[model samples]
Target chain A: MPPFLYIFLGALAVVSALGVIIQRNPIHSLLALIATLMTVAILFIGEDAVVVGFLQIIVYAGAIMVLFLFVIWLLNLQVETGPTGHLALKLFGSLAAALLVTELFFILAPPHLQVKFTHEPVGYGSLASLAGTLFTDYLVAFEVTSVLLLAAVVGSVALARRLPGTDDPRAARKIAS
Target chain B: MIPLTYMMSLSAIIFAIGVAGVIIRRNILVMFMSIELMLNAVNLAFIAIGSRLGSMDGQVIVFFVMTVAAAEAAVGLGIIISIFRNRETVHADDLTLMRW
Candidate 1:
């Protein structure tokens, strides 16, 4: 990628990410997040991570964002009102975040650590190579991920389910009807 | 090819924004989105480093990270929904049930 183009995309991503935080409405934040995810996917693809880039687009921008939208609408959440008095907390958080980014930059941006992008290894972006790495070496971790997903699904269902005669709003509505 | 340092810089900036969002935003849902943003920034860094070194490990790791993020979203949103059901609010400060 051209240096100018990389910078522009990076700037756009940052701006969109800022929108995720700055927007008062969760739906707008969701939209901004989609924009950021798309730009990141493009950046990944440009940087020779073709498979991961497409996965980011499909898994994140496609599936995860839709899930976010579904929950937002299901909850019927309202726009977040301004805090009554949390100026100090906000100031403290901003200061800490600035400090952290500065520290990360100092550690990562040093001239001695600057690694030029090198030649792409054979099959670096191929499915066969990725599957080889994931299945052969990280097979156990992959299995564990399945287990984790199962547990998460079970747990979320248990939490979200409304038992009859409980204080669940849905249950109350059903009773009223 | 862009230097990995710039990628790292971009990741750092985005991650910082995420941190700020999680801390400054009172809405539980927005804080959750901020966490996802931070995870995505880290994924960018991983892919950037892998590309710089001509390795595929970074992509694999990002895949796993995305999986974990999916699970987290499922569970976290479930918790948030349950909390909303009980408390009738999603503001972080208003959640005192867990506070001492």
Candidate 2:
């Protein structure tokens, strides 16, 4: 990846991220976040993590974000109506974020920070190569992830399920009558 | 090739923005989005460092992170919907029924 292109993508990502937080509407924020994620995906691809980049697009931006949009529309949450939050919390939070960024930069800013990515043998970031490592070394973890995903699905369904027998107000009133 | 620090720095900046978003925003959904942003920022750093080291571990770890994030998002949004169903609001400050 060229330096200028990296900068441009970085700037685009940062700006879109800010847009995500700054929007008053959840839909707008969601759009901005998608843009940010897309830029990051581009960056990932530029860095040669092609599979991961596409996964970022398909999984994160595609599936998950679509779910968010669905819920937002389902709930009919148009725009935030109340005061944002305690102003003091906002001020302190911004301050804390600034401090955290400085701290992260300090930690990442070693003298050898300029180390560039040396060329690798063929198939470094390919899917087959990733599977080679995942299936051989992290095989158990991969299987466990499937289990984790199943558990999440079951748990979420349970939580979101509204039992009509008890949760329905009209049903309760009918019983009272 | 771009300097590793540049990529890492961008990661840090985005992560910080995410942190700020979570704290400064009152809307639970937006906060959730900010959390996703934070997670992606970490994924970017992992890929950046992994490539810098010429290893595939970073990419694989990112894959795992994405999976976990997906599950988290599912459960989280479910909780949000449930809460909103009962309380009719998604503002963190407003949902203080459990608060002492």
Candidate 3:
């Protein structure tokens, strides 16, 4: 929990993030993502959020990343070329993001604006408090999120199933032999 | 002893870099990594604010965001697989089926 560890982990997270961005290959990007996830999870653990930290590592670095790798393996993506879009879109996006950050700074700069990080009556970060609110006040939102996840699952399955006649070329060749 | 504000500043810079990466990267997987970077930046902000305020809401939010992120990763990777199945490419530009 030392400040140095916190800063070091944060720096590591940032570096892996850069790798994710700079890596051209999809598999390398996923590897970078996994590294970033591990560092962030360590950051959470260092911050004393034990449950969240564990969940971050388990759910993100473990299950979710495995899913990504599985799909990547299934797809067998070759190093195909991508578009070289005009520079204008990147320029516009950067300008817009900068403006947004500037506006946020201005908005948060007011002298009288006293923001409280935790205003809840019960102590936060505990499983009891989190479950209480998540099941009571925020119950509807939580259930809705589940439904959304279910829908996404269904949609993904639907998307992955091939069109009737589009037998995979490799499969077709195998069948021919 | 670095002040908490410095941590927040570093988080902000990291987030900005993530945003820039997402904007510039054409590969879907790289874009996803950039998003993870942004999320991690937010996580840093959360930890800093939580410690500064001596409160735990920031940590709680981080928990929720992490769960949501996992769900997103599952669905996103699934979608990526589906896209690759149809087009055999993971490039952002190849997602032209919807632009029409």
Candidate 4:
């Protein structure tokens, strides 16, 4: 990938990340997140991790985000009013983020300390190779993830389901009658 | 070719932004999105390091991370919905039922 393209995508990701923070509406924040995820997916592809990149799109950007949007619509959230937190808290948050960015810069700046790219076998990030390694080497983990997803599905349904008389006024009245 | 450090730096910046979002945002949904941002930042760093070392492990880990994140989102949102049903609000500050 070209250096300029990398820079462009990086900037795009950064800006969208900021948007996610700055937007007052959760819907807008989600849109910004979608942009960031897409940019990151492209970056992954640029790094030659094709399968990871596409999965980033199909899973993260596509399915997960749609789920988020669905929840947002279900909740019918209003636009957040005024500022989020106290001024002191906002200042502290910015200070902490700045400090973290500086620390990361110091850690990543030294070229000699960086991991150098080396030759890999052809088809490193291909779906076939990933599948081979996943099924053979990481089979247990793969199966565990499937189980986790199933559990999550069941748990979510259970949690979100309305109980008989918890908050339903009609149910309470019927029981009383 | 783009340098790996650039990718790492971008990841760090985004991660920091995510941290700030989590700290400053009061809405639970936005906070959840910020958490996702932080996770993506880590995934980006992992991919960069893995590519630099000529290994596929990082990408594979990213795959697992994405899966876990998906499950987390589902469960977390379900919890949020449950909370909303009980309280009719999604603001973190308003969720003071356990403060006592």
Judging by lDDT against the true structure, name the best candidate: 4
| lDDT tens readout by residue for model 4, A1-177 | 899899899999999999999998889999999999999999999988899999999999999999999999988987888778778878988999999999999898965455766876689899987888788889999999999999999999999887765875445566999
Single-chain TM-score of chain A, each candidate: 0.88, 0.89, 0.72, 0.89
Report the Cα lDDT for candidate 4. Answer: 0.91
Q: Candidate 1, B88: how far from true, in Å? A: 1.3
Task: Give a tens-digit lDDT track for model 2, residues A1-177.
Answer: 888899899999999999989999999999999999999999999988999999999999999999899889877888887678789989987998899999889877867466555666589899998889899889999999999999999999998887666665445666889
* DockQ per candidate: 0.71, 0.70, 0.42, 0.75
Tell me the deviation in Å of residue A52 in model 3: 0.8
Q: Write the per-residue lDDT of candidate 2 for residues B31-96, one digit (tens) a residue.
A: 999999999899999989888888888899999999999999899999998887777788888877
Tens digit of lDDT per residue, candidate 4, span B55-87? 888888899999999999999999999887767
The total of clashing pairs for model 3 equals 0
- Global lDDT scores for all candidate models: 0.88, 0.90, 0.70, 0.91
TM agreement with the true structure for every prediction: 0.93, 0.94, 0.76, 0.94
Question: By DockQ thresholds, what CAPRI class is model 2?
Answer: medium
Expressed as tens digits, the lDDT of each residue in A34-150 for candidate 1 is 899999999998888888899999988888888888889878977876652278878987998999998998889667576665677788878888899999889999999999999
Q: Model 1, which residues run further than 4 Å from truth?
A: A114-118, A165-167, A170-177
Error of 3 at A55 (Å): 0.7
Steric clash pairs (candidate 3): none
- TM-score of decoy 2: 0.94
Runs in model 4 deviating more than 4 A are A165-177
Candidate 1's displacement at residue A97, Å, is: 1.0
